[model samples]
Target: MFTNTDSLLPRDDVVKFFEDAKTLLELRQDNNVEFWQNMDATALEIWLREDHPDKADTLNSRICLSALRELLSRHLAKMRCAAEWVHRIFEVSISELKSHPDYFILFSELCDDHPELLRDAYIHYGLAQAVQTLMARWYLQPKAEPLAGAKRALPHTFVKASDNEALARLLSRRWTSGDRFYADRDLLRPVVGDACTERKVLIFTRLKESENDSLSLAFDRARTVIEQGPRTSRLTETFADGLLRLPLTSSAGYLEHVRSRVAVLYLFDDRALFVEYPWNRSGTGHQRLAHAYSIGDKALPVQGTDYPVEQYDEVDTLFGWQQVYVPELPEWAAKALAGPSVHVPTSVRANS
Candidate 1:
């Protein structure tokens, strides 16, 4: 929830939001994609209007309901992670749309109108909404029954919800570019593997040998773009254009791999190379990039009127190399270097 007083949704009202989603998903067949697109949560706006006059009003609401809690479970099963949570941080904005076509097309369109759409804070919001849109598709799939789907109430945690305080430290870290020093060089070895070194960094993508090349190419292409950029006029813009033009498909798998590699290059490597599309909009993360290239202010690159991307209701996020560098890590890291023992969880996910 945000620090804004008027914006907070009480514990129970947040739960009601889920019940309403369940009820609405239960109510329709969704035979026409166009129809839902046109209506796009206006129906939901009315359904929950008394509670939240506008659907956006529901932003920052706590999703501590049993069903949502179940979705935040540490264990994943049947596209649901309903287990006891170690910690849950859900900052949702525009959680679901009335429509089901929330692929890259929808994202592009939204970015067209809302410049804030590309910020790091809202990145997961869009991702979560995409998941909801995908969930709608699953419920509306051929031979599937919305009636039963609503009853199942499979709460899907969106974005990077986590139980580990260690991750909160990193994800919450201020986004930046240019060369900066980290606190403990060894602490990042897990996330950066051997890459966190003065030697030319190599990406250890924690993927099976069979599936690695496909993702590795993504890194190679990104590197090619970064290497070719003109530092004077188009370094950030060239990289930005390349990011927009990259052959990287916006599939669930591709995004996972892209982000993993993005973190590696940005953190372990010296080049700003680039970060997410819109940059961090809050003017805090990578402000120089935003100031220099308007990275966070530009509309997303879209093809034609609509962009097609794989729609999914849930994203399986793991603690990657970036997870170890919490906001305070630099300070803590420096202290740990000079001092005695301090407990810091190393990456089990990174390749040994």
Candidate 2:
């Protein structure tokens, strides 16, 4: 489902524009750039709004502005040039740039040579394409049937590691620092093991007390899985203590407690996860999780509807959070953790 056209500008056009822009900059004559002049950030914003009213409020425009800001900042940092002079060279008209889709790409390349502008872009534009290609080769094909026999349950042992060093020792391998921002195939080699071609990995994390620490770890794990390959793993996060099987008792003699928490769902086919966690504040985790779930399946869908129920799928058996079930975990309780806008099937609600 991902295409190269999803970028604000095509890669080829971006490179070409960078070359052209560089050539233009070499021409220092006053007649070479009569309209080119420096402007502040506010002036730049005003010019964009005036020139391209239709695109002024769009996401692409925001990305363009972000790219420009970075470019200006970088120039100022290196050259110590006046902001106005930097603007003159960079601030061509926003309306005119729209006609040439390569403008933003060119600007971005000139600034940071990276394929993605924002973190979301890295996920959606860069990672999404990689995932889509992998999914087409794996999940879309007919799966082979298991051999005819009563299969014994695979023996599994749970090992608790106090820290990364302990985890590395348990795995009988040394751990290396990994780039958490981008997923690459080699980073996941150790986690997937020798039968990496056939086996799948799933990373799940649920945080109860430390939201910031938990989410950060979740993202790191997700990126590692992603770099390994699409369909190799899926990552999900929830702020509910119940999801992690942590005991929560009410002091007011109430059976259920209603507290806002956040959850994140990442599909292998898409690059970006659904929810944006607040790394700074407290108590908004549930609200952030609910907002992510509400965005529909264009990103992550409601479990049991778009895809089969996985081990980590959290469901509310009742109309609300009064009762919850995680079928894979085989856990049920009256006071279950549930997101505010989590999707509930009509049949499940009716049964409740």
Candidate 3:
């Protein structure tokens, strides 16, 4: 099978030796196998560094020799009848492999280059150890956080506001922006045209204690528009409250807020409109506001945003801050937010 050998070797000499060994294994018709018929350690060393200007170092020689010997052994194992040619190429016996100073390194490289070789228990252990060491070295490297400006286009529809006035203006704008078409008519009419069955409108929001009245007014206007529809049953709406406190300015707190807020929206499976009022403190101590909207199951931040959040711990009191009956919540989420032994408040259950 074809393989990229260049990725395995750091030096040209090592690469050449690996190429020759691979060629021997493939047994190409044009290749002169007879050249290795009487090959020995001294002859192999000369062949390994034939075109190189500098003399071969002891380490390179040993690495190449160890690689060739192991390849020959594997080849012989598969094609027992080729023992004569294998012995000629690998003058050193299998026992010599154990005593070779560089055998472990070579064997680990072989296992990495051809993972199928890991079917052998010894090769698997050597490969595991080698991989562990490499991972350890990688973990020691310093890493830096990505700049916020590097973010790509957001996946969901979002708008930002600088303060409470801006937030109120944004909500008013959303309410009237598309209401003209349904002004004289009905809002839910467009949603449930001919359906006589019961329909539900689910709403998710982050309620601020100071701006509750304005926010409630906005919600009432939205409901009024929906109630204009002609339906067999009264329009049912579910409003789930988000975190009472905003996240701290630190990256850790910001990420925790995001996870908890997102989880609230994820609990509702039916088609619902989720609105978020995220507030963060600026260096000047002014609160910045941002609103995000998404349809059911289509909302969470793009995969790129998840990387930064993963670096921090999840908020502990995720769902505990506010409790609402979400009978449709997936079993996993229910267990994660509230254990089996936890009691649900009567008022919260009734509202849910």
Ordered from best to worst lDDT, the candidate numbers read 1, 3, 2
Q: Of the pair 2 and 3, which is ahead by TM-score? A: 3
lDDT: which is higher, 1 or 2? 1
Instruction: Encode model 3's per-residue lDDT on 1-352: one tens digit a residue.
Output: 1146855533554446556644433331111223223233343334334433264563366765565555444433333223222232234434344223333344355446545445542532333443333222223234453455432111121122222222222233222111111010012222222221111212232322233322222121110001111221111111222122222221222322121112112111122122322211221112111111111122433233211221112322122222122223233322232322222111111110
Per lDDT, the best of the predicted structures is 1
Q: TM-scores of the models, in the given order? A: 0.18, 0.16, 0.17
lDDT per residue (tens digit) for residues 133-209 in model 2: 22233223454444565221211112122222222322232212210111111222222212111111222322122
TM-score of 1: 0.18
Top TM-score prediction, candidate number? 1
Candidate lDDT scores, in order, read 0.29, 0.26, 0.27
The C-alpha stretches of model 3 lying farther than 4 A from their native spots are 1-107, 110-117, 120-142, 146-203, 209-320, 323-325, 329-352
Give the lDDT of residue 327 in candidate 1.
25
Better of 1 and 3 by TM-score: 1
List where candidate 1 sits over 4 angstroms from the true fold.
1-165, 172-185, 190-218, 222-241, 244-352
Ranking the candidates on TM-score from highest down gives 1, 3, 2
